[model samples]
Target chain A: MDRLVESTRELLWERGYVGTSPRAIQQRAGAGQGSMYHHFSGKPELALAAITRTAAELRAEAERQFAAPGTAVERITAYLRRERDVLRGCPIGRLTQDPDVMADPALRRPVEETFTWLRTRLAAVLTEGRDRGELDAALDPSATASTIVAVLQGGYVLARAQNSPAAFTEAVDGALGLLSTASRTPRSG
Target chain B: MDRLVESTRELLWERGYVGTSPRAIQQRAGAGQGSMYHHFSGKPELALAAITRTAAELRAEAERQFAAPGTAVERITAYLRRERDVLRGCPIGRLTQDPDVMADPALRRPVEETFTWLRTRLAAVLTEGRDRGELDAALDPSATASTIVAVLQGGYVLARAQNSPAAFTEAVDGALGLLSTASRTPRSG
Candidate 1:
């Protein structure tokens, strides 16, 4: 049963909701149709489960970075520099490209919640940094956090488009360079 | 024939490659099977045409901003702030999420070329800016151009995930803010 969900997640990451069918999931999970149906009602149900799990795992992975000991810039940089499969794109972020997932409220919820949670979490970290004088006082934590998150998601898109990680690396470096300058400046965060 | 190509592009935007079937394109284009078949041999051929046309349109649209009179910072900001179908996502960027599109060189070429052209065009403008003393001499044009492109694509993903344009707006603002600070600073850009 757990393997079913895991397999579905992998499929969803690679193929998306429209491309991921129940038969594929069953085949990947090594489960019969009877067993698959017995476990979940249908594709959507199984996808919802898979998406929910992915969201949770993403949050947990981010928490590890956010909770690590460091100044706000250091923590944020660490989060940005956190290891990622640049070529594979993000599990949750990839769902935004899935038409069926975006069209279905039930399936979209977990994805929406995951990004919202990420932005909020990142913003909280920025706020702490600002309070601690690590970031410019005038910086908008929420906006900056959103930008950081966007750079990552967008970097994946660029990399995927080019079929190379060089563009992704450049985007990240450019963003970090800009942010580093902000931290050093005293005016207009 | 032009209508067929245009309709195919619209369906590709809404449904992606796998989801956009010949029947759907035919129906959307109001062309009979005979007409669609007469114009293009199959889905892949039609899709290639559609993607190529789309990539050209995107480049032309971007040229409007890049060619406008302004400082490098101003031009980049205008490009970022350009009007967009925020919720729908980038036509080319969205294709990166489609497996079938990414799998085929014929299909992927337009997408790859679009971004490559975009990054290159943007880099050229940045390089010119540095030469004109509108930007810091040390700024890496290629890196900054890639970053700018990333923000736009990433902004679309963030907006779609939240089902709101606010995050997208925040991200653009954040990127622009960072750029503005860099422009004002004495550091190597």
Candidate 2:
């Protein structure tokens, strides 16, 4: 069961839901058809488990930064700088491109919940920064959070498109610079 | 030949490179197998033509904004505000998530070139803004261009993940706000 779920996670990350097949999962997991069937009802059930697990892991990883002691920019910078495979892209964000995954309610639920949680959590942190005057009060927490999340996900897309991590790094630097500049200078009318 | 390539483009946008099949393209185009075969050797060849067309169209669309009379911020805002199927994601950006698309250099080249062209064009416009004293001369054109591109791509990912266009709009607003702030206020030491 564990092997089956782990294989699904890796496959989903690498090829997305549509490209991942039960047969491929089984072959990669080294589990028999019967054993795979015994563990889960079918591919969707197995994939749900994999996606749920991935979402949980993503939240936990993000929480580490959010909970860390720092100004808003520092935590976000840490979150952005956290080691990532720029070319491979975000495991959860990558699934958004898969029509099959997005089409299924059960499969889509975890994805929606995960991003919603991420955005909200980031917003909460930014709000804290605003309360403490670490961020410009003019900056909307929710909007800035959404942009931060977008920059990270979009950075992956640009990096993959260019077949280089430099694009990703440059984007992070630019966004962080913007936030840092805004934090100190505030917006001038 | 036109029908075949157009069909391939539509399928690729909807289902990605891996999910799109020659038979599906042929069916959608109402072209017979002999016609598809005569026009292209196989799926890869047809997809190349389609991707190339999409890249060309994207560049042309961007040029419309870049060529317009405006400050750098105005041009980028125009580019971002241009109507998009925010929920469907960028036609070219979506291909980055496909394992098959990324694996093939022929397929990947157009994607790479398109983004590279976009970044360079945006950077050039920003450089002009600096020269014209409309933007902070301290800003890195290449890095800022990457962030703009990333926000668009990331906006798509966030919107798709949340199953809404609100996230996309919010992200765009946030990035644009940052650029606007930067444009008006030179970085303070």
Candidate 3:
């Protein structure tokens, strides 16, 4: 059962929801057809389990950066600079491109909740920074948070489009640069 | 032949390369299988034609904003603020998520070229802005251009995830605000 769900996650990441099939999942998991059916009702159920797990993992990973010791900018910088599979793209963000995944609310909930949580969490960090006078008074925490999240998501798009991580790195650097301008503390070279 | 290519473009946008099928393309185009084969070798040929056309259209649309009379900030603002089908996502950017599309060099060429062109064009505009002393000396045109492009691409992902355009709008507004800080002339309310 674990292998089946794990294989579904891998296939979904590689081929998306519509392209992933029960046969493929079973084959990849080394589970027989009967074993697969015994585990889940169908592909949708299996996919939901996989997606849910992936979303949880993403949040846990991000929380580590957000909860780490740092100022708002430093925390965000850490998150942005953190190592990522730039080429494979964001597991949750990539699902937005899948018609099958987006059309189903059950499958889409995790994706939606994940972004909402990220934006809200980032905003809180920025708000804390502002209260501490670390960020400019003019910075809108929520809006800035969205931009920060968007950069990562969009960076993946650029990287995948060019088949190189260069674009993604440049985007992160550019975002960090712009974000620094919003810092109340004058950055030193 | 025209109808076939147009239909393929629409299907590719709606369903992506992997999900779209030749039969669906023919049916949507009102062209028979024979007609499809007559004009193109197969799905790959038809898809290339469609993607090529889509890439061209995207460039033309973006060029209008980039070419309009405006300051560097205003031009970038115009490009970012231009009314878009926020829910549908970017025609060209969306293709980056299609694994099959990315795997094929011929298919991926237009996607790569479009972004390279967009980044170069945006960098040129930023360079002009910096040269005119409209932007800060510290700005890196190439990297900043990638961030701008990434925001749009990432904004689409956000909007689609929430099934609302609000995230996309917020991202743009946030980006514009961050960009304003880099302006030499103080922004007026």
Candidate 4:
């Protein structure tokens, strides 16, 4: 059962929802068709489990950076500069490109909730920074939070498009630089 | 011939390379399988033509904003705020998520080149701004350019995830606000 879900997640990431098949998942998991059917009603159920797990994993990983000891900018920097599988792209964000995944509410909920949570969490950090006078008074937390999230998502898109991580790195550096301009104190990383 | 290419482009945008079949393209274009084969070798050939055309159209549209009369920030604002089909995502950038599109060098070239051109073009504008003293001396044109491009691409991802254009607008507004910090002269839009 575990293997089947894991295989579904991997296949979904690599081939997307439309392209992934039950046979392929079963083959990858080293399970028979009967085992897969017994575990889940069908591919949709299996995919939901996989997607939900993937979304949870993404949030936990991001929390590691957000909860780290740092100023708002520093925390964001850690999150942005954290090591990533640039070529493979964001496991959850990549699903936005999958037509079948986006069309299904059950499948799309986890993806949407993850981003909403991220934006809200990042905004709270920024709000804290502003209260502490760490960031410029002019900075808007929610909007800035959206931009920060967008940069990371967009960086993955650019990196995958070029088949290299250079673009992603450059985008991050650029965003970090712009963010620093909004900082009240002179801080170096 | 034009109809076939146009149909392929629309199918590729709607369904991606893997999901789009030649028969579907032919049916959509009102062309028979024989007619499709007569004009192109196969799906790959037809897809290349479609992708290439899409890339060209994207560049042309971006160029319209880039060439418009404005300061660096204004021009970028125009480009970012330019009306877009937020739900549909970017035609060229979306291809990056298609494993088949990224795996093939011939198919991926146009997508890669489009981004390279955008970054270079945007950098040139930023450099011009710095030279004219419209922007701060500390600004890095190349990195800033990458961030701008990333925001737009990332905005699409966010908008699609939530099935709303609000995230995209917020991201653009956030980026524009951050950019104002780098500007030498006070400007309002």
Top of the candidates by DockQ:
4
Off by over 4 Å in 1: A19-27, A30-42, A185-189, B21-42, B131-138, B185-189
Error of 2 at A70 (Å): 1.7
Q: Is candidate 2 or candidate 4 better by DockQ?
A: 4
Candidate 1 per-residue lDDT over residues A1-189, each given as its tens digit: 999999998998777777798999999999999999998999999999999998999999999999999988888888888888999889889888777898899998998998889889998998998888887766788888888899999999999998998878999888777777667445443
Clashing pairs in 2: none
Of 1 and 4, the candidate ahead on TM-score is 4
Which residue pairs show backbone clashes in model 3?
none
Predictions: Cα RMSD each: 3.4, 3.0, 3.0, 3.3
User: For candidate 1 chain B, which ten residues in a row score worst on lDDT?
Assistant: B180-189
| lDDT tens per residue, model 3, B94-119 | 88878789999999999999999999
Predicted candidate 2 versus true structure: per-residue lDDT over B121-176, tens digit per residue: 99999899988888766678888888989999999998888888988999999987
Candidate 4 similarity to native, TM-score? 0.91
CAPRI docking class of candidate 1: medium
Across residues A1-189, which tens digit of lDDT does each residue of candidate 4 receive? Answer: 999999999999777787799999999999998999988999999999999999999999999999999899999999999889987788889888778999999999999999999999999999999999998889999999999999999999999888899999999999989888888765443
User: Per-residue CA lDDT of candidate 3, range A21-114, in tens?
Assistant: 9999999999999999998999999999999999999999999999998899999999999999899789899889788999999999999999
Error of 3 at A144 (Å): 0.8
**What's the ranking of the predictions by TM-score, best on top?**
4, 3, 2, 1
Q: Is candidate 2 or candidate 3 better by lDDT?
A: 3
Candidate 1 — number of clashing residue pairs? 1
lDDT (Cα atoms) of all candidates against the true structure: 0.87, 0.88, 0.92, 0.91
